[model samples]
Target: ENNEVVYELLADMGWTGDSIDLDSWLPVYCKARYGGCPAAMDSAWQQFRETVYSSLYSYPRFTWQTVVPDTRRISKLDVSDSFLQGVELFLSCADSLESSPLYVNDAIEYASYYLAAKADDCYKRALKEDSLGNRVAAMQQLDRSVEILLDVDKLLASHPLYRLEEWVDMARDWGKTDLEKDAYEANAKRLITTWGGFQEDYAARFWSGLIKDYYIPRMKLYFSEQRADLDRWEENWIKAPWHNTSTSFEDPLQSAIKLVERYKGE
Candidate 1:
């Protein structure tokens, strides 16, 4: 009976038949059951989703950089209009689930919310550290932001509901024979193109190369010199060659594929 209930809960999350990994889910199921029956599990899921949504939407449209006086110097990079729009779109998509369900499996949505919130928190901490003139601490927070945001694709690839490789493999297989693209193929291409295209306003990212090679180094350059003129320092830094090169800009779909491939090899 307990096993049956666990399976039923998995079914609710769209995992069915042999696709359900009981071993991976048993601990979560047991923990959920400790509170009560199936209702407990359902309530827990709802609470988790709600918490993620709330955290994501709690920040203003332009975020902490705009609100905080100290961060105004680097406000453009810290909270760009493009970054805010991407975040808004992400949050909006998550919120839409409340009124209209789209996907059969919402694990990807949950992961997206969790990752975006985590990245935002890291960015806020970085700004706080910068305001305090603690370059080392600020870089640490920025590193965390990179880690969190870059892991989003990994989460999607591994999660049962949104198996990135599986979808890619299936799409490739179908493309080999089918002249007409299916809905899944079309949707997948659209998501990749839309998120990965030249339009920077739609996609948000803090990938590994951009962080370690770019943002961290850029911050180092900022802190290397001791300047009395805060305004001049900021102005000079923004105009610096490294600053323009180190900006957080990349193809999201390509990054996702690279990470997915790395995961597969590992």
Candidate 2:
């Protein structure tokens, strides 16, 4: 989401002699992206820039990406609410903009961000339940959270740029032999999960393969109350053979539509 917007701004600055593009850049970028920048879309992006992208945030990775209960993971609802408003406004313009490939891509990403925030809400609740010694309730909420993450992966997979397959496949393709292939793939997975020493998930991404095969499974073990050596588990996964299969997917906008409808009321 930020990448496209930043690129748009940078590209515009490159062309303009003065190198100044502010709110005006958004509609022009939107028009170039979706073929037309309607008023609602303009407003949505305005809110997005003001609220979400206006400054740097301490946490780039999601709370669940920590893979453990953490006070730092507790996000303020106000920010999420503001971001959701932008998402809603963006989707409201879908009737006119949905046909654009860029719009479809952004729809999947924007709506996925909404669903991810909702899932993070459940993760926080699960942490609270666990703190209260309500194991059953905690487990239930954790299950729901991971379920949403898996679904988020599905929604993300609709776009080529967001798939974990692209990450791993690109790395593996760099190898000239099976050993090199495995080494490259392991390094690729390791970068996202365990980059050596105490930085598990420091570079975590909300990608399809990572969530389904990596994050969700790790979360399950974390909440299962079992004595799990997470470091060992993570290492095993990194060195293990690649198991994520790339699949055909629906149009991104269609996936976004179904996903947002399923979780919006939650």
Task: Name the best candidate (by lDDT).
Answer: 2
Angstrom error at residue 70, model 2: 5.7
Colliding residue pairs in candidate 1: none
Candidate 2 residue-wise lDDT, 1-266, digit = tens: 35677776776677878856567877877887789988989888877877768775554666777776545433333345667778888888888987788887888888877888788888878888988999999988898898888778887887768778888889999999999999999999888778845544666687887778888877787776563777678889999878775343566576676777788766
Error of 1 at 78 (Å): 21
List the global CA lDDT of all models.
0.39, 0.77
Off by over 4 Å in 1: 1-37, 45-105, 158-266
Candidate 1 least-lDDT 10 residues: 240-249
- Give model 1 RMSD, 1 decimal: 15.9
Residues 159-198 of candidate 1 have per-residue lDDT tens digits of 3333334443465465644443344454543342223334
